[model samples]
Target: MPFLGLQRQLGIDLDSWLLRQSAAQPHGKAGACHAFEREWVECGHGLGQTRARRECQPEYEDFMECMHRTKLAARLKKILDQRDKMIKEGKYTPPDYQKSQEEPRP
Candidate 1:
């Protein structure tokens, strides 16, 4: 093969191999090196434990908040459904429609 042609083929193959490796990224690998390092650190020393605890507390709080919000929303939805049922049974009356005499100026 011509020298330039061989070099071009080798360069193209190397680029393709690198692109494949980058794209495949082998399964179950942590996405970021810094984050993985921090996780590993958190598993080890007293300082790491303190730092991890501080970092993780917010995540725990956020998770709890999400659960609380979801529960609240579900409860609200159930109450609304009960209200609708009561209205259908003539046990509840919604407020009378009040037609505004004029649209409020924005």
Candidate 2:
């Protein structure tokens, strides 16, 4: 409530303010991709709109990959496959889960 009043007094839109704040902090929901995001921002910071797109291509691609989680998904899939293999070989024992009677069926 107080923040809303302050924003009104400062003539700042809440949505744009939140966007600026998120842009300032790279290590947000993007997690390990912060480095890529930071690099892309830095690369494109002062360049003109046209030049930035041309010069920051690599950084942009890296940032996009980080944002899209392509690498993370592959790594997770590999780890999951390894775990499955171990489980099948009886090298890893998974914890047992008991289904509750009160639980609704899907």
Candidate 3:
């Protein structure tokens, strides 16, 4: 295979590994796949660690953003669960089912 293609594959593999290492987050994360392009810019030797780190910045940023969003999703789920529990316990009232009142005309 060509040199750049091999480099690209190496980058992709590294990103995938990083994502799997942190997969506890959630589904929408798309894990590391979301930042493969950024990974491609930064993998391998001779770039100097600092420069490589700069190149990898985009990937790092997206990974954190995905984690934050996933946490938000978890928070929403928690809130919804609490709401449901409250409604069930008569601590709060759920709005009556309104869809049933909408006439379905033949």
Best by lDDT: 2
Badly placed stretches (over 4 Å) of model 1 are 1-62, 66-68, 97-106
Measured by TM-score, the strongest candidate is 2
Give the C-alpha miss distance for residue 85 in model 2, angstroms. 0.7
Could you give the C-alpha RMSD of every candidate to the true structure, in order shown? 15.7, 9.6, 9.7
Q: How does each model score on lDDT?
A: 0.53, 0.70, 0.60
Could you give candidate 3's per-residue lDDT for residues 1-106 as a string of tens digits? 1356785866644434453433444764554545553453446245767886777676666656564677678899999899889978999876778324776799
Q: Which stretches of candidate 2 lie over 4 Å from their true place?
A: 1-38, 45-58, 98-106
Q: Rank the candidates by TM-score, best first.
A: 2, 3, 1
**Predicted structure 1, TM vs. truth:** 0.32
Backbone-clash count (model 3) = 0
Worst 10 residues of 3 by lDDT: 14-23
State the displacement of the C-alpha of residue 91, model 2, in Å, after optimal TM-score superposition: 0.8
lDDT of each residue in 1-106, candidate 2, tens digit only: 1353787898765543433223434444534666776677678777878999999999889888767878889999999899889989999876656323476789
For model 3, which pairs clash?
Answer: none
